[model samples]
Target: MSDREKLEARLVWERPEPASRPAPEPLSREQIVRAAIALADADGLAAVSLRKVGASLDAGPMRLYGYLSSKEELLELMVDAVYGEMASEGPLTGDWRRALSAMAQRTRRAAKRHAWFIDLLGGRPHLGPHVLAHVEATFAALSGAPGFEHIDSVMLAVGTVDAYVLGALRNEASKLERGMNQAEWEAVSGPYIQRMISTGRFPMLAQVVRDATHPSADVVFERGLDCVLDGIAARLGR
Candidate 1:
């Protein structure tokens, strides 16, 4: 057989190219949303531009507009996507404290998974389905807790844990960006403390600094949750 005939016979239909596909007919909204989410995850929210997202999907920025109304809508969608990462169930046992603790730990783990999610504003509630699911789950966890009488107290409790977790994660991101190990950071900041000690301009500040430590946020987090639970238990009369 001729070379052309032999080549035609040997062609593999199932081995079609991924990158060479004709951009998948019409672009999907889910496609655009996934591309946008990944862009923010890889680079950061600041780096997520419509053009960049479209380029990733082998399309143009105008195509993305057909999926999302605006950049703000895209960001809101991405925020909900992160909330979808959370598990909706609490601890197996019916103990309120244990359930809440499990939730706080899981939520903190989610922050580590999606660092971009820390940018979500806690004061303003987003009504996205995934975010609403998260709220429903959290309230369910503390359902029988004594002091969680109303949504206000429940919100305050959840807000405290979320605020602590978000702030801690942001600080962690900052330390990572500074490109120094914890020991190196402490060593560099140590000299400023020494200078203050010797100058005595602020004796009280120096004393406090001398005793201060950069404890892992986990430690502070547990302490803060303990406080919240303590208050709740007090109200429960347990």
Candidate 2:
């Protein structure tokens, strides 16, 4: 099979049910996915494996193959499940800025809820139904914007906003995964940084350390999102 066909094959939604019989009872695709997500939520993604998931389900690992062919397929389902969570939180607004901003913030919140989400992101396209719906909703919102008459403009707008969200969320998730909060980070590295600034060789760094107002993560995220949205508005002549 071609690459796209292989991907499609892995999508349980796309496959038709066998006319003769249903999947065996007491074990299901949904159960497997739910178990895997729970395992991932408690432990990191590394803790999730077919064996562990099967164990959680009180089934042998081989039984899981009836639903999921491989770990990669399970991951696709897990990521798509998170997208479903994002959609459930709220609907996108008619205004482009409102829609995009909401999406970025909502996605960040999702990452916070599912810390392993960042690890599954990137390196491949998410072709699941929920993700495709998100892409469609985003395109619809952007298309209604003033300067987004052309498809290319809409695509660019989506890409720009998505890039910012992914970068910011990844940064935040990485820190959390390291078991360090902002205060903890500062406590560990602050002494070395202050010592460096004391030499007077890094005046700008010292000035920032001395004068910059350290805001909460949420505030900083909002400020950065506003900057991105402002640039997009300027480009779109809104």
Candidate 3:
């Protein structure tokens, strides 16, 4: 069968009901997905496997196949589970800017909590219910805005937000993966950077590095988000 067909068959929301039988096993797809997420949370994505997840649940590795056919499926479900958290925040209010900004911040927070999540950001297609719900929320936020009446415009706006958030969080995740805080990163790299600046080869960059006051990550994120929203507003002529 095609991969799409296999995925459709295995979707947690689309699984068929089993024939009448004895009581259900203590294990479930939800349980398996949660176990995998916890593994990823504690030890990063590479540490997550059906074997490890099963051990955590006191079940055998083979037991996971009945719920998720492969590790790929497990990753997909884990991503959707995160999307579920984003969706549970409820629908957007009429103010698209505020709604989009709030969504971006929430996504940033989720990425921070689950650093492994950054690796999976836009890694594959997510047709899971929660992922679709999040998409719907994005559309709903921009639905009636002027100059965004076209579906393409709505999608572009949403995509722009997604792109910005992913790019920002990618940088954050890299720092985390390196186990270095901002100050430490600077301290370690500062000498080389200062030497490069003093060479006069990158005068503009050197000026900015020397003269500009670097903001905290949170402040930088908010400011970047505001700039993106301002661009969107200009496009919408709002």
Q: Best candidate per TM-score, number?
A: 2
> Which residue pairs show collisions in model 1?
none
lDDT of candidate 3 over 73-106, digit per residue (tens) = 8888888899898777777776778878988987
User: Which ranges of candidate 3 are over 4 A from the true structure?
Assistant: 1-7, 10-12, 17-25
In angstroms, the error of model 3 at 62 is 0.6
lDDT of each: 0.70, 0.85, 0.83
How many angstroms is residue 121 displaced in model 1 relative to the true structure, after the best TM-score fit?
2.6
Better of 1 and 2 by TM-score: 2
> What RMSD does model 1 have?
13.1
Best by lDDT: 2
**Residue range 1-238, candidate 2, lDDT tens digits:** 8999997786776774333323444766777888999999999899999999999987889878877778998999999999999989767886888988988888898888888987787777898899999888888887856788898988887788888888888877777866878889999999999999999899999989999998887898999999998998998775
Instruction: State every prediction's TM-score relative to the real structure.
Output: 0.75, 0.90, 0.90
Clashing pairs in 2: none
Give residue 59's lDDT in candidate 3 (0 to 100).
Answer: 80
Measured with C-alpha atoms, the lDDT of residue 85 in candidate 2 is 92
Worst 10 residues of 1 by lDDT: 11-20
All models, RMSD in angstroms: 13.1, 2.6, 2.6
Off by over 4 Å in 2: 1-13, 16-25
